[model samples]
Target: MSAEPTAETLSRPPTTSGEAVAVHGVTRRFGDVVALDDVSLDVGPGEIVGLLGPNGAGKSTLLSLVSGQRRPDTGTVRLFGGDPRDARSRTRLGVTPQETGLPPTLRVGEVADFVGGHFPDPVPTPELLEQFGLTDLARKQTGALSGGQKRRLAIALSLVGRPRVVLLDEPTTGLDVSARQALWDAIRQYHAGGGTVLLTSHYLEEVQALARRVVVIDRGAVRADDSLDAVLRRVALRRVVLTAPADLSTWAGVVRSRPVDGAPPERQELFTPDADVLVRDLVVSDVEFRDLEIRGASLEEAFAEMVAPESTPESTPESSPSIEGAVR
Candidate 1:
């Protein structure tokens, strides 16, 4: 960094500010379309939360409200016990949007140090660069970096201020496997240092690896909010892949079954509530099977079940609390 890091620039935000985030009955709309419907969530101080959802599931909209980029049509959003819209509240906040516009001409180190200058106390540019695995690219211009490097720098920029609460929107979107893991490690270190984080992602592995507390959202509403294990248990569907000669669609506990397209028509997939029960049924019926494999359903399947229109008869904002209450 061209700017020298001084003692005055190494300060940190107060860490005991109770709840770092509080959203109550937030509603936002664009024209006639409701982007968010009376959604409310809380993230305590020093907690890491991942808002998991598919594209356009209101994940970005909710993060926008929390970061004060946009206001909710109705309801409130608080950060560190103050209105997020207020400058004072935002001073303690650091945010990375779904996409960031970096000055192409500026070097990576220069951009970081410049942003750090805006805060009362900021992390040292070199230290921040080391944390995000960007130290090697410090002299490189922002526009010359690869997509993954740019993403890593975007997230690193959010932490330059050493803010108490950090909000990240789709932090690893479009990143490669290695770059994503490197960014995840940086985020983990930030959380390890007691920095409260609220991030949104459509990647299941991203949420699964980073967040202990997850809030699943779909179609502009909260579907499930709980521990990762509890969320997985709630959608406990097993996927059984095998080569079965007899039809498995009629098996007990089978949610859905379909034949996989391949040579000899032997491959098939059986989605069931209990793979053991289905296997027992198969054994009792003398059905021939081969290459059998039983595994837990993917997050995509769980998300599908959560958002499936036929699964829930009630899809109104008024019923949200009751459903959430039931989950708790």
Candidate 2:
């Protein structure tokens, strides 16, 4: 490991206003196909920002550009106030790309040792392996590890540096629920130790669980950026599942309702945020509720709605989406 500035030197906290990572008016094109278009966003130090989008939405392109693996055709990108290609930037950042870059024939420990050499004050190789639950697999070739093991090993390589900023591109791809939970725990610990994390994931649940804020991109542009709660509230979808005692005839503003096709034929309800008022109206209509369950808008629904084709018009007016809801 390379020598590092001591805690006293690094103790000056980053400014809340100045971005830890910034992308301004960024644009990238490959033979006229725009991968990114005039996009701008920032990540604050010690924040976990979820970068989200559908397939071909340019999430990977944005990450690659920031990591210096690929450069933008137009606009500026800065990491801790410097170009990503700068030596300081490279040393301060850790990246786990979607594709595993490890050599198949290399032993797990060897790979960690190699990557660890690039950082200042690298974690001990043995400790790194243990931290990622790869200690038993240390002597095994990378090729022999199972998919989940390989992914975990890849994460270990990135963490060897104890980087200030971490770019995790789909960090939980192959893991089962338990393994994913373990990874989330580790990431939380990283943040607690003062690391900033930027993640791109197809799993909405994962983002909701892990990210404090989220940025949704679609069609090469930013669609939404705000706190996770804000995105869900903006979508404003409501689900009301209930069993009714009466026939429950038509009620105004009730979007859709159907009898669940079970032996009991309980009712399943779907509606918007207007359901609160509609429920009041239901009393006048003499509807009886035997059982009722209400669920607020979910991140999955918000993400789908934001990236849906029809929401394209909403993307232009705001650089990023804003939310006004409290974190639950």
Candidate 3:
């Protein structure tokens, strides 16, 4: 294939009309395992959507179908206005999987230029490097780069082609706090430029950081899809901490409760939908309660409740052996 884009490619515009990603009643199965079951979602232009799900919940499978890495067993997958399997459609799409390989001998700048060369209007190598904070390491070979640097470069490559839509699967799996923040900034810049993003994250904080809209998937099914606050509201349970006279687990609003072990006497925690009513009852009944505290649940707490009673597999930074090769 030619490194440079042809006129036909240049003439084709970004995904400016209709949904950037559309999946309707899609079912994808691997042998006996159903990866996706009747999944339907529409992501409009310039939207940042977060796909949150536990491991084995089909997050990766859904991304694979959308990115054309795998064909769905049933239903349709569309990218831009065309089929995802078509190169013509993929021209407007960019992707970074959970894991990526870098050429060991290629310098950072060289790799960027080589990838950028494939697009009709690629970001300039210098400008891209500077934007991603890879300018200082421009001359450094990939083999010598640190884990965080490789991750930053991997994401930077996704935008090299100025794609209108990008699919990221667990984008920030492993990185220091500062490096993760830098990547988040880059993502924000791209979205602010009207680029649409659909990303899956194991970290609730990551989804909270980048997604205005959140979609929770479980057992190959969509549990919730709405604005961040709206989805969080799904977890109506509240936490009440206090020093009570006796067990509060049997209280009217309490869904679950436990004693703060190894602490002061009668110290307990109560979870309920209405914290105010729960506390009001305590005061009305004149329960010998002291140090009462009530607060709304955080995003993390909500996530835990949403996918309760299941073990969530975390996607930590991959610890892989060094890859030795040279390619753009």
Candidate 4:
């Protein structure tokens, strides 16, 4: 029951400067605490950008500003080059916040229709429900759906208006693997039809799968914003796993080493900047090792390094000049 792109999907408004979303030097505070500090970001039309950060790192607050739920204290947020706070500007924008309050007594289909009725042009309720895998729950009351179903319906409603840009805050927080993949497909379909998306997720793999560009925020500041490959490459660490007779934790070229849990005592995993150099050292030293394996760092490893307490701004790769000072 997948829905094909409608005429409205192909007729998005031309963006100013080719930017779907623009946030410049935005700052927001909550009494004594600064939620966002001089953050600036831009999402081009038709791009899927991932916003990543720890809890209370201002990720939600930033989305609130972009979605016009909250105003910035000292900067500007624009949707298609217009003030986001303006209703006319928001007509083309869609948002799924971390929490949504659906009508308890309304059926799923009824809620979809109610939301779609607000826009001049909207995706048909049936098609939208099918695309999100909610057709079976169409007749069920909103409060009766499971947590994951509610999340899917919330995301589907965001697209009822066929918006040019959508902001998703933890869209797959409660979804299972299958449900998450289904939602990913729906997002891809929307993007293929020239829609722009900005999403935040704790799942690193979600960002790795959907976004070409990644923006990492921590401590109320932009830590790094660059292509996913560039961000991963910035962390030069590689993981090497092998079974060795002798302890390799103190070996030269090994940045960190630990025993592989549930494995034999000889099985060790090592982190090193250069796997080749470490292997060379192992061979030269006549180390007795077997089952050797070497692989590049994962997004999780890269993220850990990026937000590590010891990481300083000066240590950041020159390619990611957008990174602000170290997380304090």
Candidate 5:
């Protein structure tokens, strides 16, 4: 590839007409054990999709298939309407793995420049370093950076090619609150610039905040794929906390409320999806309480219920090891 392609040769014009990614009846297995089972989904341009599941729930496998690192045994995966494994097709995608795989001795700027050399039109090394908060450490060796700095550098490296679709697997793994926030802002900017993002994260708050849609997979299959609002409504289990003025038995419509062990009996509440009607009737009937709180079910809670071990195999690999190699 040329060191740099001009605006006309390098930039892939924004397309309002492509399925950024598409997987149909995808399945993969290891001998007798299935890793992914007939999973199918579509990601459109400029959309951020969250993939949520428990350990060994095929989250990483699915991402690998989409990124062309692994092929599905039973189905087809298309990136920009071409085979995922094709080199030309892959240039359109960027990836950030959970662990940093950067060379320890390379300076931050040098590392970015080295990776950028692979692209026809790389984002300027200095701009990317600054964009990811690594400007101050531009000449610092990767080995000398802190955990969060290393992570930020890894993220900057992933974007060197200015890819159209970005796959982020636990993109904010080791960053502190401020650093994590910075990454989130960068991601928002990426999406705003018309790039597609597919994120696999165990952090429910991360998914809820960043993803416009979510695809929940369990037992190697897609259990649910829908918008955040729709998914939350379907995964209807709310957390209810309240203070009781009298005995639990006296409270009407109280599904269940027992004092926590070693806790005051007067302070009791329970979790239920029907919080609106349930609490409304109680208050109307003169139920007295010092405090009350009703919170919606989070993606974590929904994920726990969806991918509970009962539906998966007894033993399986917990996590995929991060791929490591020099960026050639």
Candidate 6:
């Protein structure tokens, strides 16, 4: 067997291609379990694409193929117009897996230096550390850092090579809101410099904040791939929240309803395709309500709808079909 590719081997000169990533008719499986099935996608240079899916939905599997950690059972995966498995093709690619292992005895700065040493042109260690709020922790040992700090450090290390494309898998999993926002800014700054990113996140707001394009996968297949706005617009459900004396789950046009947890017993949330018609009908029926709120469906709601088993053509917006309450 051949030796595993080292960081230096994967840090060759960058490619000047227009497309940063391309995967076509790909399928991957682990024994009898299919992780990705007949998937195809292309990402252009400088684009920030969000890959969203529930746990075990093949998000990681797809990333593995593009990053050359695993091969597709069929079809091709490319980075900068070359085969992804080739070390030269991965030269411009940086990646942070969901879990990263660091040398326990190495200081933070040392770790960054070690990774940066593999590339011909690396971001200065100090500058890279400062960009991710890790300057103060430079002397800390990897084993001693907090979970959030370690997460930040891992992401910072990915950029040390000045890679043209970065793959982040749940990049902000352990971060607080402020740290998460800081990382977002760092990612934006990198993208401003023409870096491309393909990230997977469980945080809907994270995707909303950073990604112009969204790709959603479920059951090892691509369910939706489109611009952020287009994907949200595909969800016809509108959200309506109000406080009422009686249950409104049976209301005409309500596709789903559930009580707002932790709120007053009378507070309820409902989803309908046409909020205007629902509100007018509530007024016509003289139903007493207060604190009424109506808004477009959120990304969470849109995701829930798209992944629902009944979201097919047979269940149009006009159909009074019900689904489990939208993901909170």
Judged by TM-score, which candidate is best? 1
Q: What is the C-alpha local distance difference test score of candidate 4?
A: 0.80
**Could you tell me the TM-score of candidate 4?**
0.76
lDDT of 6 at 325: 28
lDDT of each: 0.78, 0.74, 0.77, 0.80, 0.74, 0.79
For 217-288, candidate 5 gives per-residue lDDT tens digits of: 766889889987776565556656777766654344443333533457677645455778767877787778
- Root-mean-square deviation of each candidate, in angstroms? 8.0, 8.1, 10.5, 6.8, 9.5, 8.2
Stretches of candidate 3 exceeding 4 Å from the true structure:
1-17, 97-100, 235-304, 307-328
TM-score of each: 0.79, 0.74, 0.75, 0.76, 0.75, 0.77
Q: RMSD of model 5, in Å? A: 9.5
Q: Residues 1-328, candidate 1, lDDT per residue (tens digit)?
A: 1121232123433445557899999999999878898899988766788898777789889988888889899988989788888777888788873334888899999999898998999999999899888999999999898888889889988989988789888899888888888788888777766677888887777887788788999878999999977875666678898987766666678765555544355677777777888888788878899898999877555565576555444433322434433322
- What lDDT tens digits, residue by residue, belong to model 6 across residues 1-328? 0121232124432346557898999999899988998999998776789997767779989998998989899989989998888888877888873445888899999999988887889989999998888899999998898888888888887788889899999888767898887788778777766778899876666777888898988767889899878765565479899999988988998876767766887998888889999999999999999999998766455555566565332222322234232322
Q: Give me the candidate number with maximum lDDT.
A: 4
Model 4 lDDT, residue 126, Cα: 97
- TM-score, cand. 2: 0.74
Residue 244 accuracy (lDDT) in model 2: 75
State residue 326's C-alpha deviation in candidate 6, in Å.
16
Q: Which tens-of-lDDT digit does each residue in 1-328 have in candidate 3?
A: 1112233234433455478899989998888877888999998777789998766779889988888888888888988767888777787788873335888899999989988887889999999999898999999998798888888888998899999889888888878899898898888878776778899986777888898899998768888999977865675568788997787778887765555546675888676778988889988998888998888755434444465444334221221112100100
Candidate 4: residue 165 lDDT (0-100): 94
What lDDT score goes with residue 120 in model 2?
A: 83
What does candidate 6 score in Cα RMSD to the true structure? 8.2
lDDT score, candidate 6: 0.79
